[model samples]
Target: MSPGADAPDTGRFALRGRIVTLDPADTVLDDGVLYVSGTLIEAVLPATAPAPPGFAGVTPLDTRGSVYPGLIELHNHLPYDVLPLWQVPKRYGNRSQWGGSGNPAYRTLVTGPMKVLGQDPRLMPAVVRYVEAKALVNGTTTSQGIALFSNAGARRMYRGVVRNVEQTDTPDLPEAASRIADVEAKDAEKFLARLKQPHRLLLHLAEGTDAAARAHFQALQFQPGKWAITENLVGIHCTGLNADDFTVFAAHGGSMVWSPLSNLLLYGKTADIAAAKEAGVLMGLGSDWSVSGSKGLLGELKAARLASTAAGSVFSDRELVAMVTRDAARILRWESALGSLGAGMRADLVVVAGTHGDPYTSLVDARDEDIRLVAVDGVARYGSGRLMRALAPGENLEPVPGTAGEHVLRLDDGTADTIVAGLSLGEATERLAGALADLPALAATPVPPITASPGGGVRWQLALDEIEPTGAELRPRLPLLSASGETHPTGPGIGALTAAPAELEPVALDALTASDDPVFLATLAGEGNLPADYAGALARLLT
Candidate 1:
């Protein structure tokens, strides 16, 4: 924004920081310059290098922190993230045992409520606005898209400030599928054939600690030694898989996404990550959802570190950080364009509060308050007030709550979905919290336009994947035998919401960022499934 800046129309600017480029050699420049032009990174050079052509007159931003690629969350149910953490009722053996249909606690606490929220046209925009903002505060640039349904049951992806892996209109950013066609899912042969067509398909696999959960994976071997997994099949939470199972997964070019906290909270244990590592399986970390999981990938990283230590320091800070950065991009088949800071790549990166200590740990251990800036496609979306004023002036910035009011968010740019425009963060938080507090009222209320809706007049209600049927399932309940030798799916699928809620169960809205949640640390420590040492260590670190 300097006086002599050349061609501001190109949106050219320079950011200087301690860059941690996760290139092939893992390059780190103590004082680096990230030159950006429009939507792509022009070059990553040292501060001593001569300024790039168009950046000569533009004043460079001294981030005064360590810079890394924006965190890419491979797995998350974003809409459900508005709900607070679930107080697990008991240790369940498998996904089927505590099916969203059978368990009153899950049905009443999780699925039933989401069903109402996702179906309401008037409240749908609030769901999209709140969750996407939550992702921004936590430094996540890309995540799974929210699937919406029309009155006639037409499906569409929710477009928002956050880059959705499900749909990216541009060719460089290939669209990944979180939901496949119904035809592809019901048949094993069809699912395998879809994997061979060259695209990343994220599906939940073996999500429990019992034999029934393991059977979901075992059934993938349609015939002896012939598995349905391929590099394109990115399984979410292979908790039920054994060391040998990971060997097979890697052998078939498959990868895995781990949500340690969610697994530990539901079952008594999590995946045997050490075994997967031994088998050379590529793994990425996901926050899953706010209920029974970390608020975001930042908290997820801390939980991962704790779990890693309990497993005898199985992964270093560098490896754990990579899961959400470099490794995560690779899982989505986008290594060349994102998940790393490189020339000609997308300008998606984050700046944390420090330039000292282990750079990798700086990012892995950071909280929301410690984040200095988050830029996606070279546009500042969230950051400290000073940085936002400089990077995104006249963009109608809103103060991001849960950061002690220190950080601000700018979503009014062309980036935001039309449904989210003109909607303040405060309004979205209030309406969503109030709706969750009274589920019965929300379900019974008419869909007529209310004064609070910010969508102008567009009624946008996306079907919540895994809750309501949206063509295909996010987690495949592949065919397997039940304990009674009944042929059925080993894992649970979209369960029937048997009846309407009879009572008004008040549920607290989940905290926007982990750093601001008063009880977030305590809840992690109190989880009965986590080992005493792991729980204690996490508490002490956060405290």
Candidate 2:
């Protein structure tokens, strides 16, 4: 949906909290009040400051927590949510060495399962929803990855998806022109020319700890007869690049995306972050994929801290936070629209319990449960059940089972509707373990061998049926409300709500249930929560 649609005419509301604005000045307000007008942030001021002259009747949403801009995940593969960590018998020098053609375990476990799942169009949306929920619960509001679902409707699930650069033969300038075949070089040239356009160019380059991996950066730099690197270039996992390589990249206005968890898992080492930073390369953080990475960007942030410390480079908590927020947005060329909490910018934000003296430190230490609210464009999409009701009273709120106080709010774009709540990080992952249980292709596919004898080789076997549901059983259980506006025990079916809230009258239960609008009432029940005062304000809101 276009961000403007269903843009809650929040007429005017002041989100009061401890604000951490990752602005150019790194402004932090101990007790801040952010006034939001529709989808834009109208003003950010101190809690004691009076409301601006024009916003007289604005409702105050007391977040009572630490508020900050939503995080940006610069790189990820959403579809890879289906795969668990699959270790091979031996390590390889680079991704190509293992992923290209050498490893039987990769083929049998990673590639084989993906190919099988890709054949079924029916399962793609489910996988997409799973991954999007995984990111949202972790406080990530923006994510960029290769498009997996063709449905435009899926785009409404998140705040934004970075537009993908068209794939060409060079996919991502693999190696220097001379090192690659003639046909590949021609493809790389074609790809490089398109970089002149205004879109962010992303590619996985030098992602290993070997000479060949480091050489990829050289190939990109001297590409023989191609255009030079530009600011649009975003290199992912530069595990092999050295200090000199980073200098060359920074000189050409290139940025790097750090996926330390994945790098450490696959290559036993990560990028020379100290070198990259010293060379003035803009850095962003990403949660590569579940296969070899942390659960999401939150976990990845911790990994980045550990990696930075081990490398003898100390990045303050605020700097680390910027890597996922402001710096990441700059890398994607979205600085004008996102990255910081400011007036005239979209209200994509995250609210967590304020437990530390420093907001940035609190953010780095936050868990999924600590996330009190996550909003995109002024609309609260996920948060505590009470918070969701207070923010968007008329909209439907679905309980995110397995989470102590979490819930998902439904969003309706004029064309379609999508949900934004998810299982807690751990619960979401547990659900993924059995995602392939019903896919027959997994069982039908043949397993390749790492050794000569069948018994000595690793096999592609999963006890799918043994996996249990990770969260609460989701059955359509709608609470029945009496004519007096009191919530009653949930009944067997939605048949109890025969009349829409707008049509209900002050009468006995029998008369209320016999009124017209059963269809509309049933629809509300399916979506979930219906407040006690829903019949009064919500009736007008829904109509």
Candidate 3:
């Protein structure tokens, strides 16, 4: 699913608010009228301008807030987000060091639980439904896709209410490729060719902060002078790259996705984003996964802000906002159709309450409670209950808890992944909570085998990307020569992938909204790997 796409719900609505149009001129039009007609933005006119003939008798929904382009998450591990934060034992230099069996808890804490959850049909959709809601509630409109496969070897990317970058059938929204086939990846030239096939190829690259991690990037030098990367390659977590390396990457027109929190939690440092910026490399934000990263993309924005502050403020609030919106869209070659507020662009935006202060800062500093409405394809999906009742009146909606007031979720269950389409949010959350509460029992329980046929025959299961033999490896599998002259793989090892279950322990389902989960902030405060200042600064921002 390179990882991320979306479609039209035929509806017309007039949204008047402060529009932060991430256009060429960077216009912030106050008291603007954003007219939406059938999933497209009909017009974005100034309030003083005469209404277009199209605004006949429509009642405008005045979002007493600021409207910015929807948050586009370039990277995430969706299914794994169901697990709570893993208190990483200690800071390691690279992924291989910590992800290996040296840590005894690896089997029990991460991989083991996932092995059980990924296979059981009874629980997989619950995982999908819950994680997607976790993202939507936080103002995410498009992100990486969740890959699911049936027992018959048929594969399909999970398409829910949120736009999946990998499977959009729409003409304007071109699909991206995340995972390279094993055959193509193993051969360097084929990998290069595969990259040229799609609009983007989002591969996990140079994740750790050590020489071993740097070697992964070096291996992309398939030849002495020529590198395998291209304009289409969107590398995730380039922590291993140095200034010179980023310069080389920029020369090739390559972009990167940064997961600073995940990098800091595991490797004690993140990507040299300052070098990336100086080298003129485009960058986007990724929440990695909830186990050691943020609960949602909005949380990642704050983390990026703090990191930028420590780096002598290499990026301003507006620049940081661009990374998630316009720059991100450009990276995916989607700037024309999405990423900004303009006439004829898709009607995709998020509203945060209050137009006070810097709109960019307000958005970056915003908590979940501040997000009043998040619309995709001109349709309201998640918002405050009052707004939902008014805008999305005909749709069946779900109630969600919030710190300030009750929020509501309106998802069209009729998505590409039919297995999850029938399950409601309440039912999905209840099942996930109960199943996770007793992991050992759930693991011990037998899973019904999926049949091969289509009509009443096949059922979808979660395709764990990290799990071997199921799908493409999450990380780039650029082979490197060991000191002994043997080839070593940069991605997960076979033993690591086939980890046997340790005695499973009960785990609580991760909280849906950060505003509702105080433990998220509390745990980060106590977390030894994060900066001492991060928790407090984050508290000030979110609270």
Candidate 4:
């Protein structure tokens, strides 16, 4: 271990305060003093401990107020910048009453919004600023985001669209398509690349079925130790994978992010949780796009606890917190830098007023408002007011805007505790929903079907009468009405049905050979054609 590069440098600083230090073990230090230097934890001494000699330059932090390590969001999407309150159904007239106040346009306007947002850089910055503002206030310092259309897809789409346009005689149509593709490619690449520089990046590479899922993984060549090297890339919500997929992911010793709520909402099912655990894969949980239900990761944890309990799972509440904290740090490969309140780790911490009543129970049941202060890399992001006031002298106290005095929270026992800060239940729900409302739509307008090959077999090519953008999941049912007015029960694969003229051969071969089960092949007359490799992949599956 080359002294873990992320370790703190040599120096001595005392953090004497109520510290919820998630260290080698979960420990709450009352009037505790932690001495650190050069990025490593030197010692966790009592506040009464004498200051080490020759440590004169050390800044004594009067944390008698609050301090803790930075928080970790194991599974998040970085480049997929969702606006706060933008993609809601309120913007669309066709949306129904059942759509609820949540962002209903998410499924409808995914393509247009993705295309437009993808074209602009400021869009991401603006969204991130808002989200970061909210996250800091809530004590979330590090997050793993699995952004949409990774760099690879963006590059391919760019080349494909450019080629498609250059070969076309129609200037306006070609230029439009080319521009859209160009924007998507550039935006995705730039954001993903930028996210990679951060300490924690989980960029999601989610695909629908096993085959498509495998396609994305295969694109990476499943190399071992890749994620560890970069210390980024947390694979979230992966499903329908074969044993080989697990082997590859495990080889890198990367973290697995399971978003049960988001998965259930979008797809009918979620990943094989039990299977993931059996493979010794480090696990973490995320709330995902829980705003639709007016929830966050804490709510996600409760849901996970119930689901796991129903399944007879043995993971404890401490284990659960690890998913959001310690385990999450492992996923980001930032264990040395975050996840615990060791001496070397940044003094980024959180204080929940006071520690009493089953710690685990309190954490699970507590609302986001329970959080006191949030620090990032030794700097206070939120809840700095009370901490600063407690540490500095009264005469030295200057006018602080957001730094209000400590709040007195009344408990059920008719007693009250004066705490510096906390999150409100109502506010948390409102803020999360408001944030979700900004997400791009995933649904698209249904178009007329264009038939391609109605050959001898049950094969019939079907194309969307128009171009429609797809999301993480693509499920389209083509109505195959026969001459007698009876509809055929058969529906072809999306790739096969939408295959353009150039893609016909491969799509046909794939449908014919991809699976042991018989496949019905079809193609839409004029959509972007499929390629030969796709047919080859399908052929391998069949064989």
Which candidate leads in lDDT? 3
**Residue 514 displacement in candidate 3 (angstroms):** 1.6
Task: Give the alpha-carbon lDDT of every model.
Answer: 0.80, 0.58, 0.81, 0.40
> TM-scores of the models, in the given order?
0.92, 0.71, 0.94, 0.51
- Count of clashing residue pairs in every prediction: 2, 1, 8, 39
Question: What TM-score does structure 2 among the candidates reach?
Answer: 0.71
Candidate number that wins on TM-score, 1 or 3: 3
What would the per-residue lDDT of candidate 3 be over residues 257-312, giving only the tens digit for each residue?
99888988888788888899999999999999998898878999988999888878
Could you give the candidate ranking by lDDT, starting with the highest?
A: 3, 1, 2, 4
For model 4, the local distance difference test gives 0.40
How big is the positional error of residue 172 in model 1, measured in Å on the Cα after superposition?
Answer: 1.5
Model 4 per-residue lDDT tens digits across residues 217-286: 4444312333221234456666544555666666656457777644443333456666567666788876
Query: Residue by residue across 1-543, what tens digits does model 2's lDDT show?
Result: 123344455566678889899999999988888888877788899878888767778766788799888888777765564555434344456665555333444444554455444433333333444555556666777665323222221211222221211221122212111011223322334345545565666667677889766655555533343334677677888888999888888887888889986776566678888899899999999878765665567667766776776778558889999998889877765677678988877677889887358888788777666778888767777788777888878776656544545566443333222322332333433333444543343436433322234344322221111011112111111222345644454222211112221211111010001012243333323322222332233222222
lDDT of 2 at 24: 99
Sort by TM-score, best first: 3, 1, 2, 4
RMSD of each: 4.4, 20.4, 2.5, 19.3
